[model samples]
Target: MRKLGCKPAVTRHNQPRLSGLRMMARKAPARLVRDHIDPAPLMLANDQIGDCTSVGIANHLRATASLAGYQIDVSTGDAVRFYSESTGYRPANAESDQGGIEVDVLGIAGRDGYHLDHGTYYPLWGTVDPQDRNALALVVAGMGCAYLGVQLAAADQAPGVWDTDRTGDNTPGSWGGHCLLLWDYTGLGDNDLVTLLTWGVRQKATWQWLHSRIMEAHGIIWPQMVLPSGFYPTGPDLDMLKADNAAFLMGNLWQVPVTS
Candidate 1:
């Protein structure tokens, strides 16, 4: 594992915590599971939900995303609405810090060093994860780039698809409350998918559900793979900058299947 050195969020991988693992063993409907042979990605893009956590995660991710010239498409407020399901912009149930948001931010950090996407995470967070929305956020008090709260995701809902390896069945993904980090998108990216880390119990359904919903148009997502903190010298690289160490950055996403 990569020692976070300064980035606290980068500590853990997709591994689950002790208590959390036990909970899954006890609650997950493993016996009721009906296996799928050649699985097809579920078409459930119209049902994305967010907890107060995503608010923080999106804020920091917006910075990293900006570095990759891609946005994470997350928000729960009109000030930075990126989707119809956005917090208050919608007519159905506009709320704040709901969760499940994607975003895009930019940084001309030219001489000003690292600049966070005010458009994507302005009222949100900067210099630190304000409220534990993302892994980095959890380490707000620290100088590193990661934290425990950010490493945790709420928990297992129920596996809606063939997630025998993780979520079981008939559930909305993982259901529980735990911490996570934003590391290891490396593996998922290799599989043409994105990966994140959590200090709490790791649940495959969390990402799986996010994937299914994204494909279903339930929320904003990238058809292309979203990898963890890595290097793409050809593109905007945030991790390389030292002068802008604590500053923020932004990026844009390509090939996004949008309804609008």
Candidate 2:
């Protein structure tokens, strides 16, 4: 939160300025850190980590999908905000400010397998924090897509402080995300052959692998159902899904589409 009537001395890139006052106040000039941010200014810390501007996501997805020659329509939004003031819709949402993500191909059926529609690995744009209604959640059951969910870490489940079992993460050798494989019947010899993308204790992978990783890291597995539902092959029974970015997806979990 910038304050009114406060200005810092201008800075030049040729020379690095040092200041004891800056260290005390912990403030950097706008010109200094402005370009360091992704996409644009006023885009960070206001929303959650993953709550990035939809424009950045859309552009990335659009270009990538186009290059791949796939029929994809990008929605990159939450379904709830696309409400009608005059219809049966209300203007209230628990995760409304949830930012947008890349949608590889919109309006296409995806069930069996899929190629990357569009997205990038910008970590600042991928962290998930609850924006109440601005945050988004999704559901798709009885299909063939990976499932993802996001939930706030328990109080004790933070870094540098935790109990033996309930202290750390769900994935053993991973961080920046977590994952769970509800079923694994697709991949290899005697091993259920599937994986998922998660963000709790570890990143995306098979359920067993993610779970084991989490246990080793944090000493406990977050109780199932504590995380928000991420994705599915089938969509919710809402008309907005056919429309625009009405899905209201923010930091909450989601899935790769399996329009089989």
Q: Identify the candidate with maximal TM-score.
A: 1
In candidate 2, stretches whose alpha carbon ends up further than 4 angstroms from where it belongs are 1-69, 75-142, 150-168, 171-193, 197-203, 209-260
RMSD (CA, angstroms), candidate 1: 17.8
RMSD of each: 17.8, 22.3
What are the Cα lDDT values of the candidates? 0.25, 0.22
**Candidate 1, residue 159: lDDT:** 25
Q: What is the lDDT of residue 143 in candidate 1?
A: 14
| Winning model by lDDT | 1
lDDT of 2 by residue, 167-257 (tens): 4454322222211212222332222222221111112223233223331110001111121222211132112221222222221223432
Q: Per-residue lDDT for 1-260 in model 1, tens only?
A: 11111111221121111111111122211121112211111111112433323332333344345434555543244212332223222434544323322221111111121222343232211222222122221221111122223221122333222222443343332232222233222122212222233212222333343333221100111112233422111122222222222233322222322231
Q: Candidate 1, after superposition: displacement of residue 133 in Å?
A: 25
Q: What TM-score would candidate 2 get against the native?
A: 0.22
- Candidate 2, residue 236: the lDDT equals 28
Model 2 residue 25 lDDT score: 23
TM-score of each: 0.25, 0.22
Kindly give the stretch of ten consecutive residues in candidate 1 with the minimal lDDT sum.
214-223
Give the CA lDDT, 0 to 100, for residue 65 in model 2. Answer: 30
